[model samples]
Target: MSVQIQAEEQRYSRQQIRDLATELLINVGVREQFPTPLEEIIHYLGYTIEEFEPDDDTDRVSGAVNHRQQIIYINHQDAPRRQMFTLAHEIGHVFLHREQEANHIDYRDGAMTPREQEANHFAAELLMPENHFRHTWMTWEGEPELVAATYGVSAEAVRVRADILKLT
Candidate 1:
């Protein structure tokens, strides 16, 4: 799916996005920095990450009061990194786009909604900041995999960030 990043404002820095997500957690009565695994973050907030063993068409979903307590539903068959991205994507929804009333993002093979697009942008920027990402990419031979591996994300994500930086 092609995400339209034109509408996204550059006003907020990546640190600001991270702060906002952290602030949101605090406002919801959760103390302490939400952990790194992302799944642990959900659990720390009193949610559960469950596996939908029989479902094939779904990637992940969040369920809880106001999704405050989130449940990350994923297919067990997905790759480790793909599942991590799924969790990060849902975290994008929960922290960034939930105010727009989005939930249960099914993996689509086509176009993305504007909100989804924005969330994807937010996710990329949050995961891989332009300054550090560009520096890392520049050190490489313009190979997306090298940078993606460094960021622990997909090559496409690296490409998008590189595009934003005019590095690719």
Candidate 2:
């Protein structure tokens, strides 16, 4: 189901989204885990996760969350690292955009709107908290591949996050 962002929906600053993600980590008691256990978080929030193969090969959809049913649906065909990011992105919708719609389906194509941008920020912060990411980057000698493995994210994700964190 396609979800629409409400015209009067509240928009959060990137910092606010990051803070929310951090708070969620602390609340879920996964703040110290190198690779955040997204499934655990989903369960803690009383949500179910299911994986399904897309009917269309060209479908750019990655994941979606149905707040009303408390389920997060992920593309089973994606790589493990991609699935992790998609799960975290869906969780971001649960926290930040659930009020705007019952179902939030994330498409990988097209330019992102403000809500999508916020969700992406939330996912990045959720998957790779700033302080831990910084420590890991230094410990790994600034190797994106190593950091990506450590964080269960893509190497590109690590690179982008490093750039965002201004980690030399």
Best TM-score among the predictions, by candidate number: 2
Model 1 worst lDDT window (10 residues):
1-10
RMSD, candidate 2, Å: 3.2
Q: How close is candidate 2 to the true structure, as a TM-score?
A: 0.90
**Alpha carbon lDDT of each predicted model:** 0.58, 0.87
Best by lDDT: 2
Where is model 2 more than 4 Å wrong at Cα? 1-9
* Pairs with steric clashes in candidate 2: none
Could you give candidate 2's per-residue lDDT for residues 77-123 as a string of tens digits?
89999999989988888888777787888878856888787878888
lDDT of candidate 1 over 44-129, digit per residue (tens): 54656766663444433322123644565665667665665666666666666554452454454535865466556555654665
RMSD of 1: 7.2
lDDT: worst 10-residue window of model 2: 1-10
